[model samples]
Target: DPTQRGGVILLSVISPEKYYQTSPLTLEACRACLRGIAQLHAAAWENTDLLQKATQQLSKASFHLTVRNPKELATCVESWKGFLQAFEPHMKQAGLWDKPSIHAMGERIAKLAQYISDQMTPSLVEQNDTTTTPQFSPYATLIHGDFKAMNAFLPKKYESACSSSDDNQH
Candidate 1:
């Protein structure tokens, strides 16, 4: 409670084996990961106001971009161009662009640049072509920009089961 201070703390000690272990790269694990991501997305979407407030507070001391207007879209495209140009020399020096796979990816991305810019145009986003197209529009939402498996934890039940199995093996 907010009013309480120095309350008793309960901690569960995990075995070394369990503590060091991570969920295996398996189909079940993949499904669980996707479910967790969907839950996180839903929660963020539901709490958009709170997320926006937090983001605004953080952005005061840093840089933040929101592409809600044509000018912002143009700015984003220009920024991407600048980034690609700045990194191109380093990428080539690293022999990354020499790889067939990387070259193909780069070609695909180049093809999409114009398409992305066209879609981001304010006129396209504001269009109401309901006769031929479905009535759908996209909006920005908060996302976990640094999501990774290393940052996730297994459910408590799985942890306990793993711990029990480890205990039996010992």
Candidate 2:
């Protein structure tokens, strides 16, 4: 069902080949994905206020979904650390990334998140006195917040057949 929040439920027919074997990924597919993501990010960058509103809604949803102590920021950080620790082993096994480099990048992200926590929030009493400059940039456009291999779909047989026909003339 399409919602007022702006999303649609899409349906597609999956081939049996897609179920039994991992499809060979091509460079062209990767490039197309990158292009799509770039376009998404560009759109988000253009709509900073809307993005911020969505972020706030997500943050509230997170609070309702978890039982972590709101007073202890380290608790939240530790949960994230645990997730990375668990995910890294499977990520390595899947040959998705180099283990040590993945660990290093995870650490870097944690450091940045810690820095944001340490600097951004202050006492509620002082909140009204505080003002923040919007952090949107022309570089920050619409981002596909959830991107994965499963989202990709190949063109139909007829489409590929036409492409091959054109290639024979070259």
Candidate 3:
């Protein structure tokens, strides 16, 4: 029948309009955003079954993913090293490295690289492994990979809806 379709149809919505910030975010606004992010993280982490299912789905999707592993840490270190190697020559050409402050900053970057390398110990990697339920080595949880101020939103209607739902739950 026309009223009872068996197949599902998906609809996509797009808007050409952009939202502009009228003013800089206040301290209270920043705090509120942080609170919202914490809430989101807690909710996702608490759901173990969902976490496992999502992990499985991601694996099946063949996505290269790592959570608090030595390899991931190494990748970060490599990224920093690559950045330094690629930019240091340019900085020197620009006479930036000649400055005492800039030279000190370069030394700091080198120290940071050493620190990152030191953190990749076997004991630490074993401790961070998700298989073991340690007290607090690495509380790996679903994270918003691209969380930023630009992506945050707080519509009154959504807040009211969430509040009402929470009240119902209580």
Per-residue lDDT tens digits for candidate 2, residues 1-170, read 12223343447777755432112334454455567666755555546576565444333222221222444444545665576676665565567556566546545554565444333222122234337645543333333323654565544432343344432210
> In model 2, where is the ten-residue run with the lowest total lDDT?
59-68
- Per-residue CA lDDT of model 1 for 1-170, tens digit only, reads 31123122335765655433354333344456678777865654535354454344322211122322345344654555565577677567666656666545545554564465343221212346645532111332344433555545545444554444532220
Candidate 1 ranges with C-alpha deviation above 4 Å: 1-24, 57-138, 158-170
Off by over 4 Å in 2: 1-24, 48-103, 113-142, 154-170
True-structure RMSD for candidate 3: 14.4
- Judge candidate 3 against the unseen true structure and give its global Cα lDDT, from 0 to 1: 0.44
Q: For residues 136-159, could you state the per-residue lDDT of candidate 3 as single tens digits? A: 213434445445655666433334
- Reference-based lDDT, residue 160, model 3: 39
Q: How large an RMSD does model 2 have?
A: 10.4
TM-score of 3: 0.36
**lDDT per model vs. reference:** 0.44, 0.44, 0.44
